[model samples]
Target: MQSTRNKLIDLLANNQDKYISGQHLSEELNISRSAIWKHMKELEKDGYEIEARQRRGYRIISFPNKLSENTLKWGLETDWLGNTIIHKTSTTSTQHIAHHLAREGAKHGTIVIADEQTGGKGRMNRPWHSSKNQGIWTSLILRPEISPHQAPQLTLLTATVLADVIYKETNIRPYIKWPNDILIENKKLSGILTEMQAEQDRIQYIIIGIGMNVNQTIHELPDDLSEKATSLRIETGHQLDMIKLVQAILEQFERTYETYLNEGFKSIKTKWESYGFKIGERINVKTMNQQWEATFSGIAPDGGLLVENKHNGKVEKLYSAEIDWFRE
Candidate 1:
């Protein structure tokens, strides 16, 4: 069931150009006029400017710049992706919270988000810097019907979603480093960590953790990561609305994910490659026992990194390896 507040937002947003009578809002939301007025006061406190006149209904003149469950749902245009949002002001990690929720039978499209993560981690358990209200730190719960082996495709699919949103929102073309990193001008902008729990051939649940640096300034970043990491604000010369960016991501992700389910991985593979960083360029590849150089070809069907072997002219799919993108 949709919350009454969200329903009110939808009713007002759908008719932005005109006023909605208080009686109509009350009838549609099954709430009294006093309750509706109280809700309006709450929205005003959340930074929403609503215009209400005598005999005229209410219309939202502007949305809030803050990030909250209600603000996020105010103008979010998704069917289910963010319908059930678990927002936190500060937490250990959204990923950790998501895992707990999924184990407790959280529904698909349930999202866990935090304004700040005290112990955020990325792939390989690397500590991810999540300053308070400086970036987007969220996790999504997915229960796909596909087998365990096919789960990696979702990671690649998510990369495409991030790249698409970044380009469209900032107008700066970003690149996807093999596996799960979004880069702009050879610097890190965002990272994705995909974890799944499966039994036999069936996946129980998958948690995709996404951490994006959005509004942090140079001084806000750690000194060690100053050169290696970049944020949307740093690159764009202005702060971005975190709520809007999150909505855009959820909207695009839902659309792309639906397409992937209806069709296949072919489209996702193509889109991923288009945003693939350093494709066709020689890069260093490192494994446990050996290191070699290969031309970054593309992504294989099973989500491995496809590289053209420097020797013998054979193509190989690498499931796990440390790719040195900085090395020539």
Candidate 2:
């Protein structure tokens, strides 16, 4: 259910080239002209510059540079991925809020985003530094009909989307590090964490959490992460529009996800491999039993990391392993 204000924004944004008269807005939103005026004032307060004339009704001249539900939805071009957005000024974790919402039967495509996360975490409970207004911290709820075994593919698919978006936005090519990390010039840029709740054979829901360092500076990052973590601003030497980046991610994810569902993981595997970090390079792979060197081959059909053994002359798929990506 879209709120009246959101509907009003949609109407105004969709008609950006022309002004929507107050009468048309009133009739479309089922509100009085006075109420429409109040809504316009509210939008103005939210940093929207709206133009109004006697005969011409209203047109948004500019949108806010803030991260709000309305601001994100204003220029969002997705169908279902972000139709329901839960934005927070501050939260412990977007992933935590998303899990709670999914448990409460939040519909698929419900997204939880925050300007700052007090306790953001990545895969294996590693704390992720999410500075306020400096990055994208978001979790997306999805209820795909695929089995739980196929869930890992979504993480890989998400990496490709991040890489593609970064490339298109900054013209910088990013690498997809095996399970869930996006790297640029051997430094971390973004990460994807996929969590799922499922029965024996059916999945209840899956939450994909993404944290991207967009506008952080060198000093903004913690001292420990200074050597390993890099941000878009640091890489490009310019500030970026987080709202536009978020919109691009959602739009690309929705389209790629639809294609993956209809076509299967074949296409996703190809795309993922194209941006694979250290592909065909020797890397240290550590399993439960032992650690060994293997050439990074490609992704298996089930989304496992395929590595070709140097001594055995055979290819193997590893589902769980610690890869020393920097090892020579």
Candidate 3:
């Protein structure tokens, strides 16, 4: 059921640039004039710029940049993506909330989002700086039919979704720093973490966590991270509508995921290469045991880095290693 507030928003959106009479709204929504006025005031508090005149009624002048459930749902085109959104004003981390929800049988496409994450973490348990209302902290619940070993491919798919959405929205092309880091000008813009729970060869559920630096300024970031991290606003010179970006990501992921499940990883691998960083370049790599410079070949079919040894005529696939891009 639609709330009176959303219905009112619909009326105003439909009658954009035209004044909507309060009396007509009260009658149409079967509410009192005071109720209509209260809802309008609530909308104003939610960042909507509404113009209310003494006799001409109300008009919507602008929309909020918020990513609330209602804002993400409005005009969002997707079949199952974002159908069930768990929105939070502040939390420890959306990934933690999503893990609990997935364990308790949250359906596929259930998204947990927060405006600010106080205890957010990234790959390798590194602390992710999530300033208040500055970035996206969201997690998605997925129950795929593939085996547990194939779960890593989902990370690649997620990388492509983010790359595609960022380019489409900002017109600034981003590079995927293999596995799942999005980079611009060699600075970190986004990170992805994919966690899974499986039994034997079957899969239970997977939680894909995405942390993006969206609207933070240089001073807002920690002094330690200012040299290595960047936000979308810093790169684009302005803030973006959080709701629109989230909706675009969900729609693009759903569309690309359908293709991945039906076709295969052939096309996905190709797309990842196009946006990949430093492919075909000689770079230094550090593993747990060995550190050497190898010729960066490309990504394997199963989403591993294929690097050729410099000393020997041997090409090896590395699933876990750190690429030293500074020395490239």
Candidate 4:
């Protein structure tokens, strides 16, 4: 069943530049004029300024501009990746909400977006800063029947989706700081946080949180991060339609996810490696106590870093390490 409120929102957003007549809306959507009026009143109650007049019918003046269902549905042409949107004004973290939603039997492709996340978490337990109206911090819940080990592949796929959208929108090529961090010219632009609830053999649900520095100015970043982090606006020198960016990302991810499901990772492995961080370069890494410089080989078939130590002429597969490409 199509909801009248959502249809109205879609109509207004799709026709942002022109006035959509009430008779047309009623006829096209198969609803009555009084019902449309009731729905418009409902939307007004939800902070939408839908103008009504004698002949002009209705026009959406303004609304909360974010990654809401109305925005994604209007912009995204996908079957999933935003089928169910959970929006909050402020929360501890969208991932937490997604986890709870998953526990309560939420469907796949459920997305949780927050305007401000007080305790926003990062990949390695780092505190993610999510102030009011500064950036985009959201989480997506997916239920793939694969095992826990295969979940990391979703992270890689997400990295590819995000990078693809960023490149498509800004025409500013960004680099993937392996595992999953989108970088622009060498500074951090976005990070992916993946969490899961699984059994010993089967997986129940996985929540992938992506925190992007979108629309935030250079000075709005923390002092410690101002030198190493950048937003889409800072990188592109203009503010982006954040909602549209989210829509684009979701659409790309939906396509890629379906492809990965139907065709497997081998189909996209070449594309991933093509955009890989370093092709043939000697890099230094700080694992835990000792720092070593190793020749950067390509990734293993199972997605592990292959490094050859220069001093010993020995090779080892690294499951985890901080790759220091920048000589700082």
Candidate 5:
């Protein structure tokens, strides 16, 4: 039902800056005159500038940059990714809501988005700073037909897609840190958290929580994060329209995900290596019981980090390791 209204808005927006008659909308949508009027009024209240003339009917003047379903659906061009969006002004976490929905049988491509998250989290349970209407906090649900061992490739897929989207939108060269973090000029710009549910051989679902700092400024970040966090606005010296960024991400992700499932992770890994952070650079790493300086090579086939320790000149695959890229 709501998707129908969104489709109506998409139609009106397709002819933006031009008049779309109410009668035409009613006929096309198979709704009555009153229903069209009611939906138009609602759109007007949500910061959409619509001009209604008796003879000319209606025209959309502008659209807000909010992440509401209507706004996102206006120009979205994806087949399924983010087609069913659950949006919140403020919430505990989109990841939590997505998990609940997935367990309750939410279909693939269901998206949980929030303008602000009261209890957002990142990899290793780190607190994610999500300011109100300042960043992109969303979770995507996927039910892929793959084994548990092949799940890590989804994180890599997300990293490559996000890196491409950021570069296309802002023209900023985004570097993908080994597993999931995205950096720019050595400052953390975005992060991806991929969690999955699986049995012995079958997979239930995977929820990918993506947090990207979009329009926040240096002053908006906390004192501790001021030195390490950066936003797109801060990097570009101007505010960006969040709707465009989100739409682009969805489109690119859908395409990349389809490619991964159809082709394989070989191409995705190649793209990830193109923007990889500090390739061939020596860096300090600390695992649970070992610490050493190793020369970073590239990603392994299974999405693990490959590095050669300086002590023995032997290379090993690291699935989980803390890296110190700033060490001299």
Candidate 6:
């Protein structure tokens, strides 16, 4: 019932720029006028502002602009990145919504987006700095059939794809920070968060949330983050077509994701190492227990960070640690 009702809502929403006659809507949907009215009332209750006129029939005044269907659908010139887009105005988290949708039999390549997240979270339950209508806050749902242990590599793969797209489209030449942070020079541009739901052997689905700062300038961010975060426009010195950029990211991500799934992780692993942070360089990393200096070798197969200790001639593979790689 929710799916059926949602389809009708989208039908009207797609034609929102102009008024759609009741007669035409009924004919197209094969439903009675009374049923259409009931649906409209339900839509109003669900938080859509629709305007109805005597002669103009019904017109959508303002959609919640959650999930951004226009950009999501238009972003799919490639194979299967954003085949489905689920949106919300304000939510606890896009990852939470995507997780629930995946459990409820949502299809692969589905996206969950939001305008402003009231409960936005980040790495280690920290608050994600999401300002309203100023950034691209969305989560992608992927049901890849791989072992649960092989999940961490997906984060590196996703990071590579995002950096590739940003450089290809905007010519920003963004760099990756280990797992999934796209950085420009030394400032942060975007971040990827991948959460998986899997059994002991097989995999169910993974929710990959991407938050990209698109058109924001230095003033949009809070004073503290102004020095740390940046947008594409800020880095490129021009306003970019958000629609095209979104499409490019999804297309490139689909290509890379498919390659990783079909072939082994060699393709992604190689590319990721190339753009990865501190490759073949000595860097300082701190674990929860202690701090050490190690030469960054590369990523392991199970998605661990491999670092070779210069002082002791030993190679250590770290699973999970708070990494603050030295810039200099």
TM-scores, all models, native as reference: 0.90, 0.92, 0.88, 0.89, 0.95, 0.79
Worst 10 residues of 2 by lDDT: 319-328
Give the candidate number with the greatest TM-score. Answer: 5
Model 3 — TM-score against the truth? 0.88
lDDT top scorer? 2
User: Cα lDDT for residue 24, model 2?
Assistant: 98
Model 6 stretches with alpha carbons more than 4 Å out: 1-67
Question: How much is the lDDT of residue 113 in candidate 3?
Answer: 93
A best-first ranking of the candidates according to their TM-score comes to: 5, 2, 1, 4, 3, 6
Residue pairs clashing, model 6: none
lDDT for every model? 0.91, 0.93, 0.90, 0.82, 0.91, 0.79
Q: Give the per-residue lDDT digits (tens) of candidate 4, residues 1-328.
A: 3456677788887887778888999998899988888888767765678877788878888886655555555546778668788878799999889999999999999889987999998877998888676678889999997878888888888888888898899998887767888888778989999898899898999999999999889889999999889999998889898778888888898999999988877755666676677646778866877789887776677667778888998877776787868364
Candidate 3 regions off by >4 Å?
A: 1-8, 17-45, 48-62, 326-328
Clashes of 6: 0
Q: Where does the lowest 10-residue lDDT sum fall in candidate 1?
A: 319-328
For residues 209-253, what per-residue lDDT tens digits would candidate 6 score against the true structure?
988888788888878888888998888888777656667778888
lDDT of 4 at 257: 90
lDDT (Cα, tens digit) per residue for candidate 1, span 1-328:
5689988888887899999999999999899999999999988887789999989989889877778889888678888898889989999999999999999999999999999999999988999999999999999999998889888889899999999999999999999998899998888999999999999889999999999999999999999999999999999999998988999999999999999989989999999999988898888888789988888988887779988889878899988877867463
lDDT of 6: 0.79
Model 1 misplaced stretches (Cα beyond 4 Å)? 10-24, 37-45, 49-62, 326-328
Give candidate 1's TM-score: 0.90
Query: What are the per-model C-alpha RMSD values against the true structure?
Result: 2.7, 2.5, 3.0, 2.6, 1.9, 4.7
TM-score of 4: 0.89
